[model samples]
Each structure stands twice: as structure tokens, then as C-alpha cells.
Target: MTAPSSPDTQAENAEVIARQRVMRVLAQAPDQQLEELYEKFADKPDWTFARKPETGLVMTRGRIGGGGAPFNLGEMTVTRAAIQLKSGEVGHAYCQGRNQRKAAIAAFFDAAWLSEAHKQSVEANIIAPLEQEQLTAKKDKLKKAAATKVDFFTMVRGDG
Candidate 1:
């Protein structure tokens, strides 16, 4: 067995995990959501992209009942983009569906969040709102699923 990761490594891993969470939330949000966010920014930030937005299929996987065996969930359409801000922060995004503009917007947000000047403002105005909307939607979905759940029970026989 390997020893535990160092404190600095652990912190870096934590940040990576948080970034993943933010990106996942952003990717699932609707295109209009991002469009609104784009309008909220004051001045346009200069950025150079490594490549134009591209769409491709990605193979998705799932585990049987959460943790049993892994299985392929079939291919999904995804759009990806990578960009670097003028200040040198790089960001990337892979979003579900064929909306390349959504991916580019998300990537720009990711890069902007990397800078200390924009971190707090972006997190408050963009990430926080998106995350809250996602959480609310998730709760609504869970409530719908729970409403359809049926409880099965056994009754004892009086003759026994």
C-alpha cells in the first residue's frame, strides 16, 4: 500500500475535484443559462483558443447498481474546447450534446476563474448560481422519482 498523499498534494487534488464539480454543473446547464452569464460580464476578456470547438462521440460507462460491474452506456455526443486567457490561465471544457458555443463559454469561465482577480466574482455570479440551479433541478427529479416509488410489504397470516 502507498502512503497517504502529502498535504500540498491533497490540497491540489481537492481543487481539481472542485473544478470537476463546477465543470460538470456547467456542462449540464442549458445553453440559455450560459448566454445569460455571458451577458453579465462587463468587458470582454481576450483569450486565444488552442483549437476550434469540436464535436465528437464519447463512450459513457456505468456501474451495475452503483458498484458491481462496469458496463458501457453507449456513445454520447460531446463538444469540447480549450482556451488560454491573455493572463496565461488555461481552461478546457467537454459538454454534452452538440452545442460547441456552450463548451466555449464554459471553458472561458473556467479560465477566468483561475485568476485570483476574477475568482470570487465569477464564483459568486456564475458558478454559485449555476450550482444552485442544478441542485434544485436534481431535487425536483429525485422528488418525481420518489413519488413513483412503491413500497412492498409482507403480512403475517392469522392462521400461523
Candidate 2:
């Protein structure tokens, strides 16, 4: 048995989960889309790069049949950035691909989200729209795939 988490711990955990969700949406968003959405923020805050955006290869792994033993799939190119806001918030982001600008923008958003003043606006303008777009795209893809699905049934013949 283990001790239950305190209220502060639970709140911290929720914050971490929310941040993860934001990062996931940012990572999946297209570069053009992310840039367009980012531009919506009129008064962008001043920030310095803790770590400038850089591209590198990361090894990917996969499990056989989605359940069996894991195996190294291959390497994937990823861009990552870290930024520190003048207000003392630090943010980091990792995006798949070699788009340095996208990674930087994502990191900026991450840091901005840490600020209580920007959290609600960031969630409303950036996170919500991106998540909706992703959900719509996923639904469209599923609809198309479902349309092509084949159903077959076996016929039985009576024999005496």
C-alpha cells in the first residue's frame, strides 16, 4: 500500500497532463497551420531560447501486432526547442520533422501556457482550435476508410 497523494500533488499532476495534451496537439499540427494560428497572438511576449530549435534523429520502437515483443522500428527526424519567458516560465517542445520554426513556436506556446495570465487565452485560441482540427481530420479519415471496408458472409445450403 502507498500513501494517497495530497491536493497539491493532484493539482500538479493535472497540470502536467494538460501540458502533455497541448504538446500532442502542437506536434500533430501542420507547420503552416501552426504558424497561422500562432500569428493570431498579437502581443507576443519576449522570450529567450534556453535551447534553440534543433533537428535530430530519434530511434522509434514498435510492438509486434500492437501487443507482442517490442522491436526497434527505425529512426525518425525530430525537432525540439526550449524557451524561457521573461516572466520566468520555461517551456519545451518536441515535434516530429525538421521544422525549426514550428518547434520554436510550440515551445513559446508551452511557456506561455505556464503563465496564469495566458493559460486561458492559450487554451481557448490555440489548443482548442488545433484539437478540433485534428479531431475533424481523424474523423474524415476514418469515414473514408470505413467506406472502403468489405463485409462478407458465408451461405449455407441445405443437404439431406
Candidate 3:
């Protein structure tokens, strides 16, 4: 016999639906993650996000040694993202600066919305880009640092 849907089951389903929406927003880069929610896909991944030009600032108010006054040290541009997976899984990520992780997770959820047949394609195209970018960035940084290595020389004075 089939079991009836209880209140607890309905609540659980609603929670699941909420999670899917969050994922769609965090999928785009950090800046795009904060977009407004619009449009919903049934067959494809559902949920939407939008972007607003917002400045994120990091300020050092003051310290005990230098507590004379407070000042803004730096600012960053931030974006928020969200995505809904095909299986109704949702994820979100908010980050400072343009970040690929924000986009990959979002794309991952988007791919999750697709049939298993399309998953590999989505992963290779969407997720792979970020991973490749990260690897390249790391290698370049190491190469640059290696190129800047310096040697120190010491001289001794002779006594007459």
C-alpha cells in the first residue's frame, strides 16, 4: 500500500526546494551571485540570480598600538551566486573579488539539473574551465616566484 504524505514530509520537500534556489545564485561568479531571482525552469535547472555593482570594503578601524583613529584599508567588488540542480538541489556562494569557485559550484548544480547523458558534457565545459584556470594560475605564480630568486653575497674586511 502507498503511504500518505504527512506534514513532516511536506516540510521536508519545501526545504529541499529552497536549497535548489540557493545553488543557482552561487553558481555565477561572486559578483553575479547577487542577482535578483527571476525565471524558473522545469525541465532544465530552475532558479535565477542577478548582479548589482556593489563595493565590498575591508577596513581596519584601529589597533591598540595605533588606535588614534579608524580608516578604510581596502575595498573589493563582491558578487553573490546561486543555482538549482536538476534533482532540486540548490546551492549558494558569496565571495569577495571575482571568483571561479562561485561559478563552478553553480554550474555543477546546473549540470545536476540535466539528464545523466548531459552531465559529462556540462562538467567538461563548465566545471573544467575553473579547475584549469586555477591550475594554470598556480603554475604561473610558482614560475614567476622561481624566476625572482636572489643570492646574497658577503664580504670580509682584511686586517693590515
RMSD (Å) per prediction: 2.4, 2.7, 12.0
Question: Model 2: how far is 78 from its true place, Å?
Answer: 0.2
Residue 43, candidate 3: alpha-carbon lDDT: 34
- All models: lDDT? 0.87, 0.92, 0.48
Tens-place lDDT digits, model 2, residues 1-160: 1358898888888878888999999899999988997888967888999999999999999999999999999999999999999999988999999999999999999999888878888889999989998999999999999999989765676751
* Alpha-carbon TM-score of each model against the true structure: 0.87, 0.89, 0.41
Candidate 3 residue-wise lDDT, 1-160, digit = tens? 1367689888877766654443433343233332211112123444444332233544434544576556665565554455555455544454455654445445444545344654555445434554455568779999999999988665665751
List the lowest-lDDT window of 10 residues for candidate 3: 33-42
How would you encode candidate 1's per-residue C-alpha lDDT over 6-63 as one tens digit per residue?
A: 9988888889898998788789889998988988876657898976799999999999
Superposed model 1: Cα runs more than 4 Å off: 1-3, 64-69, 151-154, 158-160
Error of 2 at 112 (Å): 0.7
Best by TM-score: 2
Question: Can you rank all candidates by TM-score, best first?
Answer: 2, 1, 3
